[model samples]
Target chain A: AQSVTQLDSQVPVFEEAPVELRCNYSSSVSVYLFWYVQYPNQGLQLLLKYLSGSTLVESINGFEAEFNKSQTSFHLRKPSVHISDTAEYFCAVSDARGGGSNYKLTFGKGTLLTVNP
Target chain B: DAGVTQSPTHLIKTRGQQVTLRCSPKSGHDTVSWYQQALGQGPQFIFQYYEEEERQRGNFPDRFSGHQFPNYSSELNVNALLLGDSALYLCASSLGGSGNTIYFGEGSWLTVV
Candidate 1:
């Protein structure tokens, strides 16, 4: 079984300030990490993912997450925040079992990020 | 191209009743997965369908069932629903392969009363 832990349940930040959302995971096998954001009354949107080759992955919207194997962490970071960035963020992991089950994402409880102007 | 889409944006059901939610995968995608996101919780995988077959399942009980048609559209059915069954049902689609990016629909809100 694989599990993801998002350390914070809610994060408040002022616009243009830096923010980080911490996530940690436990898995028996190699894992793929992902970050998903959900706005109010909407579904999840993939922000970025870490499959291979690089430990750091970035999203088009200026968010980035670094996958740390030693610490079992995949913390998301953004240098500046915007009110539009306010949303609930989730951390997910899938084992390297591959095949049909590779898409079975195990998600974290989610962290609600509220950006203030 | 259209992304994943789900029907019955919101609905209310009584205990012991049955509910069926539908989904249409993104264009050209062949695999579909169902997830249940309870209030204030992360979405939990319910099952996945590929090639019109149940390719994988999660820890959910048999009360939660699903089907995929030749067109790659799918339905999620829950029988004998309980208050705990209230959740946001999410449908995700992706090509049947490892590392392929999966896309999610806006989701159907189910309120069990």
Candidate 2:
């Protein structure tokens, strides 16, 4: 079984300010990490993922996250946020299946980011 | 080029009544997964269907069941629904059977009265 914990329920930041959303997970086996964003009443959109390359992975929209194994953390960060970035962000984990037929993701409660203009 | 789509964008049902939700996978996709999202909570996996067979399921009860058609579309049927069942139901699709990231639909909001 795998579980994800997002420490903050809400975060408020002014436009152009940096922000970091914390996420931690507990899993017995190797896992794949992912970040997803959900806009108002919309579906979840993939932000970035960490699957075993460099410890850090970045999204095209200037968001990035670092997977810290020792700390059991995968925190999402952005140097400066735009108003359009305001949304709910969720952290997910799927058990690593080197060769399996199906894999499902375990998600966090989500952090609501509010970027004030 | 169509993404995952769900029907009856919003629904209202009475307690103890049953409801059926539908989902259509993205074009060229063969796998479909369902999830339940409650207010202020993350989405919970319901099940996954591939090749018209149930491949994986979550911790939900037997009261919740589903089926997949030959067209790769799916449906979730909840029997004896309770107020707790009122939540956003999300459907996702992936290209292959597994190891691929799931893409989600806007979700259907079910309100139980």
Candidate 3:
């Protein structure tokens, strides 16, 4: 079975400040990790993904995450955030378990990031 | 092209009633997946349909059923809906395989009054 845990429910940062969102996962087998962002009343957009190869991956919008195998973590970070970055972020893991649903994703509770000017 | 489209953007039903939600996948997408998002929670995978067959299912009850047509469109049917079922139902479309990035729709909000 695979499960995701997001330690923070909400994070507030001033504009142009650095931000970090923590995520951890538990899976008996190899897994694929991802971070998604959902703006107000909008569908989710992919932030980044860690499938294989480099443990560190980045999104074009200046967000990056490192896939720590030993720690079972994929924490999202941005050196500087803008007010437009305020949104709900989700961390997910996929593994071969359960049936169809679980086989796709085991998402965390989601973290709300609020960037203030 | 539209990323993904769900019908009846918002619906209101009562307990013990039934509701059917519809979805049309993005162009070139062969797989459609359904998810349930309660207030302040991440989207929970409900099921996945591929090749007009149910290729995956979640921890939902039997009351939660679905269908897939040859055109790759899909519908989610819920019987004996409960108040707890009041939430946003999202439809996501991916490529022909499982565990893909999966693009999501704006979602259909179902309020059980």
Candidate 4:
């Protein structure tokens, strides 16, 4: 079984400021980590994922996350956030042993990021 | 390409009643999964369907069920619903195999009274 914990329930930052959403996971086996963003009245959109490769993965929208194995953390960060970046961010994990896509994902409670101008 | 799509954007039902939600997987995808998102919480996996059969399921009870069609579309049926069942139901689709990305729909909002 896998579980995710988001350290913060809400984060408020001014536009152009940096922000980070903390996430930690507990799993008996290796896992795939993902960050998903849900805008108002919209579905969850994949922001970035850490399947395998470098410990750091970046999204097209300037968001990035680093997978820290020792700390069991995958924290999402952005240097300069825009008002459009305000959304609910969720951290999810799936068992690496599942061996394929469409595997079950365990998600955190979620962190609401509000970017103020 | 059309992304995962779900039907009945929002619906209201009473306790002990049953409700059915539908989903159309993304184009060229053969796998569909269902999730439930409660207020102020993240989505929880309900089940996954492949090839018209259920392949994986989560910790949910048997009252929650689903079916996959030949066209890769799916339907989620919840029986004897309780107020706790009021939540957003999401449908996701992905190709059946390794290295595929799963996509989600906007979700259907179900309110149980």
Q: Give per-model TM-scores.
A: 0.98, 0.97, 0.95, 0.98
Candidate 4 regions exceeding 4 Å error are: none
Per-residue CA lDDT of model 3 for A8-92, tens digit only, reads 9999999999999999999888888999999998878888988778999999999999999999999999999999999999998
lDDT of 4 by residue, B1-113 (tens): 78989999999999999999999989999999999999999999999998999989999999999999999999999999999999999999999776577899999999999
DockQ of the candidate models in sequence: 0.67, 0.62, 0.49, 0.76
A62 Cα displacement, candidate 1 (Å): 0.6
**Candidate 1, B21: how far from true, in Å?**
0.3
Clash pairs of candidate 2?
none
Q: What is the lDDT of residue B32 in candidate 4?
A: 93
RMSD of each: 1.0, 1.3, 2.2, 0.8
Q: Write the per-residue lDDT of candidate 2 for residues B1-113, one digit (tens) a residue.
A: 88999998999999999999999999988989999999999999999898999989999999999999999999999999999999999999988744566789999999999
When summed lDDT is taken over every stretch of 10 residues in candidate 1 chain A, the lowest stretch is A94-103
Kindly report, for each predicted structure in the order presented, the TM-score of its chain A compared with the true chain A.
0.96, 0.96, 0.93, 0.97
Tens-digit lDDT track of model 1 for B8-86: 9999999999999999999999999999999999999999998999988999999999999999999999999999999
Q: What lDDT is reached at residue B81 by model 1?
A: 99
Docking class of 2: medium
Model 4 lDDT per residue over A1-117, tens place: 999999999999999999999999999899999999999888899989988889999999999999999999999999999999999999999888766435878999999999999
TM-score of 2: 0.97
- Pick out the ten consecutive residues of candidate 2 chain B with the lowest summed lDDT: B94-103
How large is the interface RMSD of candidate 2?
2.5
Better of 2 and 4 by DockQ: 4
Worst 10 residues of 3 chain B by lDDT: B94-103
Ranking by lDDT: 1, 4, 2, 3
